[model samples]
Target: MKRTWIKKSLLVILLVGILFVLAGTVYLKMNTYAPSEAALAVAKTGKSEDQILFFEGEQGKPAIIFYQGALVEKESYSLWAQEVAKAGYPVYLVATPLNLPVLQQNAAEAIIAEHQLTAVVMGGHSLGGVMSSRFVSSHLDHAIKGVFFLASYPDEKGSLENFSGSVLSITGDRDGVLNQEAYQEAQRFLPDQTVYEVIAGGNHAGFGSYGEQKGDQSATITNEEQQTQISQLLIRWLENLE
Candidate 1:
């Protein structure tokens, strides 16, 4: 009888665990930020396969693998990706499970291998950037050419202090959603030569087209203006990469 009771208890725990996981998954899916109509319109021009949105560019340039911000739809970055692709660098906007890059931080490896990409740059906005940094740090042998962050910073575990690759960090001057203290602290983890820039009238939500984020400050500049500057900065940086 005791053995049977123990078995029943185990079954009950297993059932509870499964229920908890299901509930969490549903919650995450429901809370996701969908792309706006403008973003959706731009995304239609790109080709999507599986979870990746591919923006084709020049044949022999470094490819970009970008992850999406937490709970933000991958399509939200479509407009920016299209602009970058026009500059001759193919861009792959990757969608993460539950819209959280942290859940699949090493996703770029598959993309790199699938396309046989040699020179590659990995970047993202907000939480996506943090995970991309973690991936770069963990896969140093991948020979990533550069890393870029939008309103984000790497965590201690994803530090690139000794990395030789190029690093660029762009943040908005009026970003209320970004943790200033943490961002300042994370700077020590970046390489000495990292290039940092700030958009004069930008805010946290200006990095993507997912509408105004809960904690972000109002941007003086339009989203289109912010994105244009970002793409220009990114293209110039990419062109100058060694």
Candidate 2:
């Protein structure tokens, strides 16, 4: 009877484990956000080199390497990249492993080695942005001019306070998912002169072309409007910095 009971328990445990694995698989698949209409449009002229999608804008223009959020498709940033490209900056979107930037921390290395850009601005959204901060802080000698964050913050693990480059952090007022308290706390980790902006009525997912996130609030402006504002403001800031 003891042996029979032991076998039954083992079988039950195996079934439970299988169920959990199946559930996790379903969650990951269902959360795969599709690219917006603008993403499809940008795909026409996009170029790929070393697994990074490059929006070739103009020669000698500033190059921006943007990373995608966790579980979010890399091309979900196409709309914004296109706008940045229109502003005469080459935008390179790094494709992360399983759409997780944290898994591939050195994803920017390939882009930097191949692009031959003089001054590079590196950034990402959410988790992606955090890893981007890590890359920039470690690679200060690579001529990194600036770091941008979209609904993201530089945590204590990797602070940007000592970084001699510019920092641009853009957030949304109505973002329900981003940790408000943590965001405020992380401000100390950034440089004193960080250029921070809060978009009125923008939500957490406003920075990307992805669909509505689980806990995100409704954005007052369309994705196009937000992307336009971001690209325009970024270009203006880049121009005025000199």
Candidate 3:
């Protein structure tokens, strides 16, 4: 009877653990920020396969591999990626597991190998940026020509202080969700030539068209205006990289 009771207790514990895991997975899936109709319309121009959306551009130009922000749908960045592709670089918008880039930090490697891309620029929004930076830091041999961050900063472990590539960091002046303290502290991790830009009245959510993010301040500028500014900056930066 004692052995039977112990076995039953173990079974109950296993069942509870499985339930906890399922609940967490369901919560993450439900809490994800879905792309707006406008974003979806723009995304239609790109071709998607499995977890990657490809925006074609001119031949011989370095490709851009972008990672989406945590809990934000990958399609939320379609408009921005489309604009970049128009400027002459192919864009691969990668969808991470559970909308979390941290789960696949080395995703760019397979893309580089598959496309036979000799040169590449990697970037991401928010937490996606941090993970991208981590990948770039560790894979310096992958021909990464530059790194960009949208309302994001690299963690100390992903420091690029010694990187010889171009770096661009963009954020909104009214971004309430960004950790100002951490942003300032992370500056030492970026290279000396890093170009920093701030949109005057823009907020955190201006970087993507996924509606207002939780805990983010409202933006004074329209999403269109902010995205246009960001697109222009990205184009100019990519041009300079060549």
Cα lDDT listed for each candidate:
0.92, 0.83, 0.93
What would the TM-score be for candidate 2 when compared with the true structure? 0.87
lDDT of 3 by residue, 1-242 (tens): 99999999999999999999999999999999998899999999999987999999999898999999999998999888899999999999999899999999999999999889998999999999999999999999879999999999999879999899999999999899999999999999999999999998889888989998889998999998998999999999999999
TM-score of 1: 0.95
Instruction: Decide which is better by lDDT, 2 or 3.
Output: 3
Candidate 1 lDDT over 4-60, as tens digits, reads 999999999999999999999999888888888998999999999989999999988
Give the clashing pairs for model 1. Answer: none
> Which one wins on TM-score?
3
Q: Which candidate number maximizes lDDT? A: 3
Model 1: ten consecutive residues of lowest lDDT: 233-242
Write candidate 2's Cα lDDT for 1-242 as tens digits.
99999999999999999999899878876777767777766855788766677888787776889888888877788887887888788889988866888989778877788767787888899998899998887787887888899999887766898898788999988898899999999999899879988888888888888778989999999888887777777887666543
- TM-score per prediction, in order, is 0.95, 0.87, 0.97
Give the lDDT of residue 18 in candidate 2.
Answer: 100
Model 3 lDDT, residue 169, Cα: 98
Q: Per model, state how many residue pairs clash.
A: 0, 0, 0
Candidates sorted by TM-score, best first:
3, 1, 2
In model 1, the runs with Cα more than 4 Å from the true position are: none
